[model samples]
Target: MAAFNLTPSDPSTFILNGIPGLEAAHIWISIPFSTFYVISLLGNFTILFVVSKEQTLHKPMFQLLCMLALTDIGMSSCVVPKALCIFWFRSKGITVDGCLTQLFFFNTAMTVESAILVTMAFDRYIAICDPLRYATILTNAQIAKLGLLGLIRAVLLVLPEPLLLRRLPFCPNRVIPHTYCEHMAVVKMSCGDTRVNRTYGLVTTFVVIMLDLTLIGLSYGLIIRAVLRISSKKAHRKALNTCTAHVCVMLMFYTPFLFSTLTHRYGQYIAAHVHILLANLYLLVPPMLNPIIYGVKTKELRDKVGKYTCRM
Candidate 1:
C-alpha cells in the first residue's frame, strides 16, 4: 500500500513537514521544542495534581487554573508529540480522518484556552473590584458552568472547519508545511474553492481573539481603576501583586499569538520557518510558562509548591 493515498475526490492521507526548508535542523530544533513540551506537560500536570488534591485550593481561581492547565495539556499534546515524531522518527504521514481529528482538537483546545483566560480575567476583576461580593458572585457551580460554556463555544465554532474541509476535494501534494495539521494549512490543500473556509476562519479568529482581548483589556482597565482606589501603599502593592501572575500569563499567551496572526496575514516576506516557529510558539509558550508564572507570582501556589517539593 502507498504511504499516502492520493485521490482528488477523497485523499486518504496527508504529509507533515517538520519545518519547511530546514529539515537538517529539525533534530537539533526538537531539543528546545521537546524541552518546552516536557515542561508544559509536567508543569500543567503538577498544577492539576496539586489543585485536585488540596481542599484549600478548591476555590474559583484555582479551579480556573485547573481548567487552563487542562487546556494547555490538550493543546500541547496535540502539537508536540506529533511534531516530535516528525523530528525524531521521521513519521509525518497522517490520514485524512486523523488530520481532521487533530485539527478539531487543537482548535477546540485553543478556543477553550482563550475563553478560560477571559474567565480568569473576569475572576481577577471580581477579586480586585468587589472583594466583598466575590464569593457571592462566583460560586463553585458558576465557575464550572463557565468552564463548560467555554468548551461548548469552542466546539460549536471549530466544528465547521473539519466538516467543511471534509466536503472539499483535495488535490495532489497533500503536504502540510508545518509540524501539525492546522485548520488553514489543511484547508489550503483543497482543490475546491475555500471561500467559506477562509471567510469563516478569518471571522471566527477575529471575533474570538478580538472579543477576548477586548474583554480582557476592559477587565484590567477596571482592575487598575479599582487598584488605584486603595488607600494604603501596602494595599496598593498587594492588589497589584495578586494580578502580576495573571498579567504575566496574559502577556505570555497573547504576545506570541498576536505575532503569529500578524505574521500569517502580513509577514509573507518573512521566512516560512519563521511563520512555523511563531505558530508553534503561539501554542507552546503559554502552556510552558503559565504554571511557572503562577508558581512564582501567586504566594499561595508558591508556598504550596514549596511544601510539596520539600516533602518530595
Candidate 2:
C-alpha cells in the first residue's frame, strides 16, 4: 500500500480498476460498454455528417444537434478506448496528468451538453412560440456564437478542477475503483481532506447543470403553456412534437447523472460495484442514445440520413 503513495521521488501514476471485484469478468463486462461506445461513435458522427451536408436541415435546432454530437464524440472518446485497454489488455496504469486530462475533458463535455440542451430548448421555444421572430432571433451567426459560448463556459468552469486536484496529496490507495476518471471518484481516493473537492463539485453541479436544467424546465413550461392555448388539437400536437427528441435526450442525460451522484454520496451501504456501474452508465448512455433519439424522432434528419447513405 505504501508503494502507491506519492513520495518525494515517486512518479505520480494511478491504477484504474476495471470493475474492482469483477476483474475476472472484465472481459465480459467490456462487451456492453464497448458496444455502446461503438454505437455512440458511429451514431454521433453520422448525425454531424448528415447535418453538415444537408442544406435543407440548416437551422437552429439542427445546429444544436451538431454541438451535442461533438460533445458525445468527445466524452466517449475520452473514456472508452482507455477503458477497453484496461479491461481487454489488462493495462490500467495511467499517469496522474493523464488521468487529470481525461477528467477535464469528460466534465467539460458534460457541462457543454447541458448548456447546449438548454439552448435547444430555447430554440424550440421560439420556433413554437414566436415563429415570426425565430429567424431574427436565432440566426446562424447567433447560433454559432451561442455554441461557442457553451464550449467556453465549460472549459473555464472545469479548468479549475484539475488544477485543484493536482494540489491534493494522494494516499497509498491510488487505485480508482472504476473504469474512467470521474471528478468525485478520483477525489474520493485522495487521503487529503476532500471537503474542498466535494464542496466545489457540488457547487459547480448546482450552478451549471442544475441551473441549466432549471432553465430548460422553464422553457418547456412556457412551451407547454403556449402549446395549450391553441384551439386545435392538431396544432397542439405539432408544437409539442418538435420537442420530443430533446426531451428524450434530457431524460437520458439527467436520470443516470442523478442516480450516480446519489449513489456516490449516500450509498455507503450500497456495493462499490453498483456505484461504479452507475457512474460508468452516467457517461455512456446519453451519447449512445442522443443521436438515435434525434435520428428517429426528427423526420428531417432521418430522411437526410437515408438520402445521404443511399447516395453512398
Candidate 3:
C-alpha cells in the first residue's frame, strides 16, 4: 500500500459525517429532512408571493415578515441540499473551498435572521407603543436601509470566519462529525493553534446574540408596558394579538440556536449523535415553522393563503 501523502498544509477535502453510528439510517433520515426542505421552500415562497401581490399587506410589519421569510429560505437552503446529498447518496466529501463557502453563507443567513427578528420586534414596539409615528419611523426607504444594513453586518462578521479558516493548516483527519461545516467543527480539524479562531467565534456569537436578544427583550418589555396602559381589555387583546406570530417565531429561532451554541461549546458529556441531530434540527425546524406560524396567526396572511389554496 502506498504511504498517505496528504499534509496539513495541502488538505483538500473534508468528509462530513452525517449522524455517526446511524449510518444505516441515513436514507431514512433523508425522508424527513427532504420533507422539511420542501415545506420551507413552498411556504416561504408563498409568503413572498402573497406579500408582493397584495396591496393591503404592504405595511411595515408585512415588509419585515418578507425579510424574515427570505432569511429563513436562505438559511435552510444553505445546508439542506448538501445534507440530503450526504444522507441519500453517501456523497459526504466536500472540497475545502466548498465547505468554506457553506460556512460563510450559513452563518451569514443566521446573523441576518437574528437582525431581522430584532427589527421585527422594533416594528411591533412602534406599532403598539407609538402608533402615531409608525409610518414616519419605518418608511419603505427606512426598511430597505435596515435590510441592507443587516446583510452588510452579516457579511462583515461571517467573512472573517471563512478567511480565518482558510489560513489554518488542517490536520489529516478531515472527517467532520456533522452534516454541515459548522464553524467550531471545522476549527477543531485545524493542526494550527485555533485560539484566535475560537476567541473570535465566541466574540462574534456573543455580539450577535447578546446585542440582538437584549434589544428584542427591551422592545417587548416596553410593548408590554404600553399594552397595560390601554384601559380597554379589547384594546389590550388587539395589541397583543398582533405580536403573537413574531413572538412565536422569535422563540422558535432562538431556543434551538442557544441550545446548539451552548452544546457545541460546553456539552462534553452529551452524545455526539445527539448534538449533531439537534444541530441539524436547529437549521431545519425554524424555516419549516416560521411561515406556518405566521400564516396561522396573521389573519390577512391566513385569509390570502386560504384563498390561494382554494384556487389551486
Measured by lDDT, the strongest candidate is: 3
lDDT of 2 at 75: 83
What range of 10 consecutive residues in model 2 has the weakest lDDT sum?
1-10
Cα-based lDDT at residue 222, candidate 3: 99
lDDT tens string, model 1, 101-179?
A: 9999999998898899999999989998999999999998999999999999999999998999899988887888999
Instruction: List model 2 lDDT by residue over 1-312, tens digit each.
Output: 343343322357887877778889889989999999989999999998888887888888888889899988998899889888888887777888999999999999888888888999999999999999988999988999998999999999999999999999887767778888888888987888888888888898778877898999999999999988999999988899989988988888887887887777777888998778777776788889888899999988999999878988
Q: List, residue by residue over 1-312, the lDDT tens digit for candidate 3.
A: 111333334467888878988889999999999998899999999999998988889887888889988989998888999999888777778889999999999999999999999999999999999989989999988988999999999999999999999999889888888999999999999989999999999999998999999999999999999999889999999999999989889998888888898899899999999999988988888898999999999898999988888998
Compute the lDDT for candidate 3.
0.90
Q: Which one wins by TM-score: 1 or 3?
A: 3
Q: Candidates sorted by TM-score, descending order?
A: 3, 1, 2
Q: Considering only N, C-alpha and C atoms within 3 Å, which residue pairs clash in candidate 2? A: none
Q: Which 10 consecutive residues of model 1 have the lowest summed lDDT?
A: 1-10
Winner on TM-score between 2 and 3 is 3
Q: Name the runs in model 3 displaced over 4 angstroms.
A: 1-10
Pull out the clashing pairs in model 3.
Answer: none
> Could you estimate the TM-score for every candidate?
0.95, 0.94, 0.96
